[model samples]
Target chain A: MKAPSLQNTLLVTGLFTASFAQAAELEITVENLTRGIAFTPILIAAHDMESHLFVTGEMASTELQAMAEGGDISGLEMVATSVAADMATNPAGGLLMPAMSTTTMLSTEQMNTQLSLVAMLLPTNDGFVGLDSWTIPETPGTYSVYLNAYDAGTEANDEVRGSGTPGEAGMPVPPPLENVIGMNGTGVAASITNDKVHIHPGNIGDAEIDGGSSDIQNTVHRWLNPVAKVTVVVSE
Target chain B: MTIRLLRMSVATALLIMLAACSDDNDDSVTEVPEEPEMRTFEVSVFNLSANQPLSPIAVIASDGGMLWHTGEAASDGLEALAEGGDNSVLIGADSTLGSTSGDAPLGAGESEMLTLSLEAGSETSISVASMLVNTNDAFSGITGVDLTTWAVGETKTYLPAVYDAGTEENTEMAGTIPGPADGGEGVSEGREALDAVTMHSGVVTADDGLPDSVLDSSHRFANPVMKIIISRVE
Candidate 1:
């Protein structure tokens, strides 16, 4: 270790109580790293270990179905409030555009030690980006986490123009997606193969423009895992 | 003991120099400029895909520029290289501080090494990119990999994810791909796909689905397409 000089004081002040004693002022940045898929209204919450936005290999809850089917975070917000979770809803204010990024704050309470996030992937059936109950690091400088796309298994991926209502088969087309998404499609998948929530097999788009099996362009709507990148700058 | 002897010699020299300076009142000063050191790195890349022949690797060390960023449109140089497997533009582009390319195209299960040299002082970030010649605009690379803490004799390796340069459509049509598997044209001018670069949704060859595809099951590929091993040799 170096001597406790003026340089040491500056270093100490620069890296304050970043370790986990709880009650941290966290500055979280969410990056929509995908090329063509837009994220509908992201929701980030800091809760105890008991709370989870969505669990893999489990049936989708009615509240989670509503958010994954549509772009509604209201139901999830109410659930977080009931759980006494420190939450930040709709951090991007609206649809987080492809390749864009947004930042939000979560001044976590002592009891809320785990972080979770959820957002819908536009132009898809029941697809969402999820971070399920990741333990908030106590000793933190800057932490980077990559998130993958998941299927809610609540609706079949018809890949056609339909309603945003829960239990719907078609994808909800926001105004921003009206001009972008194609129209008059036959269907991609007839039913959800995996009844339980699982990793998305990704969209299988086609090249036909006027009419095709799927409305999604093969070149545009498809993506790989780890679609979004989340960076958390945790401080005292 | 060495410090004491060195201190006595320096004191005697300083006394003699002070006497000389006082006697002459000289104002002249001499300065010797220091030479800047250069660092060299050897990057060996292995094409790990099924049959996609990788284009000549582009190895660059930069300060802050990104060779290719996800969600952004690929530059003209990147589009040319991704589409045609030609690296002339990316090597001479203004974005790189120092760059080099492999001697030849690396085939499937083949490996090649290229040496790159850069001036010191800047916290250099290494960027490596190569095209999967059989697919339309499919490239694999690492952008802004920090090499600031690297020392001589240290080696680092990475398995990079594949990317779809959203510049050309992945139609698998005839005369679209530039690799020997297709023997089609290269570097055609157009932006037909989504305007943003994204993760490569694996190719749907003819055996899998796409009826008009020039490719077959042998042309299909997945992520972590290339294995890159970088060593600081200097």
Candidate 2:
């Protein structure tokens, strides 16, 4: 019995070392592919496979809502830390403008084999660009992934300038977006339609600057799928 | 007979030199000249929109050539294809190695298959482009699809999204659209307000509060308005 128990301990130790040997050096670049939309401070996490930042068709967690609604990452960072996840927060240091990109490096720990990223799209209420739980490849190579805009389902897409706090009604127009976004709009939507995270239905912007149904510019603020392009380089 | 053999040997030597210069990984040199192999591909495009009629499809095979890029201005050839249903400009581009075009417009829920053949091992990518004639400067197709690794008889499918050429505005007004819904002008002379290419924001028809728009609900569409299938036949 003692010999069997010793072998079991050795087996566990061997597995631990094997996982540690798989730890990778990763360089990630996030590019805002939109022509007009701006991405807030991005939060990228390398975590275990079981963990997820936000899952489509499921209610968004409080941490995800905070980030999606207001571009806040503190809550999400705390969650990642609690799960022993490796994270690179705010690599851009500020907003990533249209067609601009930001890069960060992360040396992932053992069991951290999945990558996720999130950043709030300015001029949107609870809309964010997200990559949910993409499996990190074992082979060392460069990989590309496209991310889409997600509706947090926590607030109405009023399309008018308002608070960025959770459960808000209107979009949070930052200083840089103040002039670009419109004003004096009534509102596009008054209630959250889908209560679960899903692909954003897109902005229904108007052409009027002072008095339209929405404060977003239809020609400028709208976008299709693949709002962001992510490039990941994996190395030993 | 001796002179003919010498000419054949010289031609084979030149072919070997050109092959070595073209491909870095191809090291083996053939002692005898052989017939150049031909590779063929079949491309099928199916329209999925309610009312948007796709223009004649232009299929091009090249070596890493792209028709249009996001966040960039449309080329004159691309602008002509997107604004009007004409695909001649793109089919005649310099990068096109082998190309084919559909003879007629593919209507809603209809599909068309076009074939192209090129010298094997020369081109490594394929591109397809067609315009949604109902809207201003809206096109749907894919660019830079890698074909070097595709096996013979291998078929791949894709659901392509719509792209706004950005050469014209989405005014949806009369005389702006060129489809049968409006029968308006095709490509105008000048560029629109936002002159850089981007994914289309979709048509804002009359049902969506664009009062002056000539389009209706049928003209509106979401992402993936076309289904594309590519197969390497030979």
Candidate of highest DockQ: 2
Query: Which 10-residue span in candidate 1 chain B carries the lowest summed lDDT?
Result: B1-10
| Interface RMSD in angstroms for candidate 2 | 9.2
Tens-digit lDDT string for candidate 1 (A89-192): 89899999999999998899878899999999988888899898877888768999988787787887778889889976798999999987888888776765
Q: Residues A1-236, candidate 2, lDDT per residue (tens digit)?
A: 99999999999999987766378899999999999999999999999988889865457899999999999999999999999999999999999999998989999986998999999998888889999888888889999999878777788777888888887678788888889888898887676645666657677788988878788898899888789999999985
Candidates' TM-scores? 0.50, 0.53
lDDT of each: 0.82, 0.84
The TM-score leader among the candidates is 2
Evaluate model 2 with DockQ and give the value.
0.03
Off by over 4 Å in 1: A1-21, B1-208, B211-234
lDDT over C-alpha atoms for residue B92 of model 1:
80
State the TM-score of the second chain for every model. 0.83, 0.84
| Two-chain DockQ for each candidate model | 0.02, 0.03
Error of 1 at B43 (Å): 39
Clashing pairs in 2: none
Flag clash pairs in model 1: A19-A138, A20-A138
